[model samples]
Target: MLLPLVWMISASLMPLSEVIKVPPVWFAPDKYSLANYMEVWSRVGFSRYFFNSAFVAVTITILQLLTSAMAGFAFARYDFPGRNVIFLIILATMMIPFQVIMIPLFIMMARLKLVNTIWGLIVPSMVTAFGVFLMRQFMMGVPRPLLEAARIDGASEPYIFARIMLPLCKPALAALGIFAFLGSWDNFLWPLIIINSQKLWTLPIAMSRFTEQYIAQTHLQMAGASIMFVPILVVFLA
Candidate 1:
């Protein structure tokens, strides 16, 4: 597995002819150059794509964390009527595949004039059943005594949540944020469907376009793919 990845990187630094030789060149004769990386960055609008993806992913992560944390806190701590039914509904929604709702969601965005906009990409991801479920599960392990003591000392619900619950749930929140960010960052089909403008294209969509336009330039395509994969690789390593 490591060998293939290293070889891909090696080939990406090679010249075009070396990349397309009958027997693929694993490495270049000369020292590695940044020509392929430069071409991908300049000709493919990789910077624009990177910024768009980062912005959308960051937006979704913040919204998901806030919304999911609040909903999870309510579900875990409060005893409102029909609470189980509501949680069950949320869990049921998780079971429904995104494909089932994609068309209707696209149409709704179109009707709302959100299609082809960054809002289209970020809005649908802001609330996630899986995120709520993850947070609720984590919050369930929190002790009732801590919350009760906070209340007895005059801590408001918001105060307790902000001061106590959030601090206690850091690991879970980090895990969820990483998951949400990765999902949004690497997303392709949804962005492709919603983003019509070149400026709004995310990394995956832009990389796909680069591959299509430079079909014969394997080194350049690999360079772009490498750039797209680097952040995820760093996150996983960390």
Candidate 2:
């Protein structure tokens, strides 16, 4: 993994001409330049892809977190008719693979006129079953007496959740945020299926096209790969 990261960065810094050299040059022969990056940026609209990815990832993470946390809270803290059955049904959906429903989901999106739109990508992912499960499990560990005490003190459910339970779930929130962001950032197949327009393409789609456009040009491919992962690598490291 680290090898790829180092090789990509080094190859990207090298001029495109040197990238295809048989000896596989480690860096620019003499003067390393950022021309490859600039070229890749101009060709792929790096900034636009970055913004679209950031928007989708951040929005999905936030919305999923809120929905998951709230749903988890309800499942853990309250008892209602068929609550367990409903929770089990939701968990069962997690067992059903995306492949099983991909075609139907596509048809639904087409019917909704969401195909080729940002919402097409985002709406489907804003509430993941895994996210709900993660939050539910985490919330279950929270003490019931504490919530009861808060209720006895006249705190509303929303107040108790926001002020008390959320503060305690920071680690879970962080983990989910990272997972959700990374998932959205690296997603490829769904976007490929949904979007036909070049202007709305995300980083992964752009990278796929980059490879097709420059097939066997390993250096350019590496540069494109580098462009794709640099931001994510920084985020992971941080």
Candidate 3:
């Protein structure tokens, strides 16, 4: 399991000759350097792709957190007309594949004039069915009596949510944030479909192009892959 990651990191640090060698050298302390990283970062305009990915991913994660938590809280704590039915509908969306909706989603983005823009990648992904479902399931475990006690003290819904509910939901929020960030960071198909401009390309798209341009430079390709891997590792650790 760790071997692939180990190889990626090791290969990223190696020169072209060592990377392409048969029975690949697993350790070459003397040959390893940051030259490939430098080239990828500078020559390949990786900085732009990195920024695009980070910005879009963070934006989506934040929006998903807020939207999911709020919706989940309402579903768990409040009762209204068709509440169960509505919740069921939301859960049903999770069963539908993204491939089934991508075309319509793209058309909607096109109609909104969002295609080829950063918001095009962001707006559609700001909310997710899985996020809502996860938050709702977690929030369901939160004791209702606690909320009722707060209300007895004249706490408003907003106050209870902000001051009490949110605090209690840190674990759920962390889990949701990890999923949202990782999904957005690694997202490829949606970005590929909507974005045509070079400047707007995310790391995944840019990395795809980088591989094509440097198909022979396995070291550089590994460096690009390593760059893509870091944020995911950070999010996991976080």
Among the numbered candidates, top TM-score falls to 3
TM-score of structure candidate 3? 0.98
Candidate 3 residue runs with Cα over 4 Å from true position: none
The order of the candidates by TM-score, greatest first, is 3, 1, 2
Query: 81-170, model 1: which lDDT tens digit per residue?
Result: 999999999999988888999999999999999999999999999989999899999999999999999999999999999999999999
Q: What count of clashes does model 3 give?
A: 0
RMSD of each: 1.4, 1.7, 0.8
Off by over 4 Å in 2: 27-30
lDDT of 3 at 220: 94
Each prediction's number of clashing residue pairs: 0, 0, 0
Candidate 3, residues 1-238, lDDT tens digits: the string is 9999999999999998998899889879999899999999998899999999999999999999999999999999999999999999999998899999999999999999999999999999989988988889999999999999999999999999999999999999999999999999999999999999999999999999988988899999999999999999989997
Q: Best by lDDT, which number? A: 3
Reference-based lDDT, each prediction? 0.90, 0.84, 0.95
Deviation in Å, model 2, residue 55 alpha carbon: 1.6
Which parts of model 1 have CA positions greater than 4 angstroms off?
Answer: none
